[model samples]
Target: MSTARWVLHLPAAATSAEGVDRLAQALRDSLRHVPALDFGELTISAEDDQSTRRRVWCDAPLGGDRRCALRTNHPDRCLDR
Candidate 1:
């Protein structure tokens, strides 16, 4: 089987990177039921500079094909959901 990637550009009223990250997390949480959505791979970028992206999740490999469920750059130890 083949998998395809999809990108959705959402415009938000957040004024800072942290605010945007929160918005992204809320969106992922609301859509958690969708199996096709890879919450761990979530990212955000400025409207003008899509080339530079900021990750929303830690997404570190946690063995057995599991990934960290913490936010990006989290100070605590990685956890899997």
Candidate 2:
């Protein structure tokens, strides 16, 4: 199966390294059900928004569009590990 490129916008409040770790872990825990694709090429950045200069950015590999929503919108489903 082919993989999809995904960029999940981390919470704006997440400015510290520890915050990034939590969000990354949350993302991993959320996608545990998908066993076909492996997540890699991960990156975290701070974009200079017009309003807010410092913003959290965390992105990784996703199986496809089907799994994107679960990680992006539904945090409740993600394991809080």
Candidate 3:
């Protein structure tokens, strides 16, 4: 049987927000040498504030449109709006 694996594409540390590197390293360290699962390419991305307002489109079996506004750092504040 083939082993299951996941690929991750990490963003450049210099361009990404602060603490992204630490977060990536934590994920990498935790996911290493697992029994049934493995991962590759832990990717991070940096986007402008306006970019977050755009919709995200999914392809293939998961085809759909998603709004980025639904995601926020402050969940409590979301309900106030």
Per-residue lDDT tens digits for candidate 1, residues 1-81, read: 888878765567577887887888888879989887788877788768879987889999999978998988999999986
Q: Candidates sorted by TM-score, descending order? A: 1, 2, 3
Q: Rate the local accuracy (lDDT) of all candidates.
A: 0.83, 0.46, 0.37
Clashing pairs in 3: 8-40, 8-41, 8-42, 9-42, 9-43, 10-42, 10-43, 10-44, 11-44
Of 1 and 2, the candidate ahead on lDDT is 1
Residues 4-80, model 2: lDDT tens digits:
87764444447775786577667656875776434333345554443433222222234444323223334454322
Candidate 2, residue 2: lDDT: 90
Q: Lowest-lDDT window of 10 residues in candidate 3?
A: 54-63
Per-candidate count of clashing residue pairs (backbone under 3 Å): 0, 0, 9
Give the range of the ten consecutive residues with the poorest summed lDDT in model 1: 6-15
- The CA lDDT at 53 in model 2 is 39
Candidate 1 collision pairs: none
Candidate 3 per-residue lDDT, tens place, 1-80, comes to 99887754443445544466556446546764664432222334555443343211111121242122222243432221
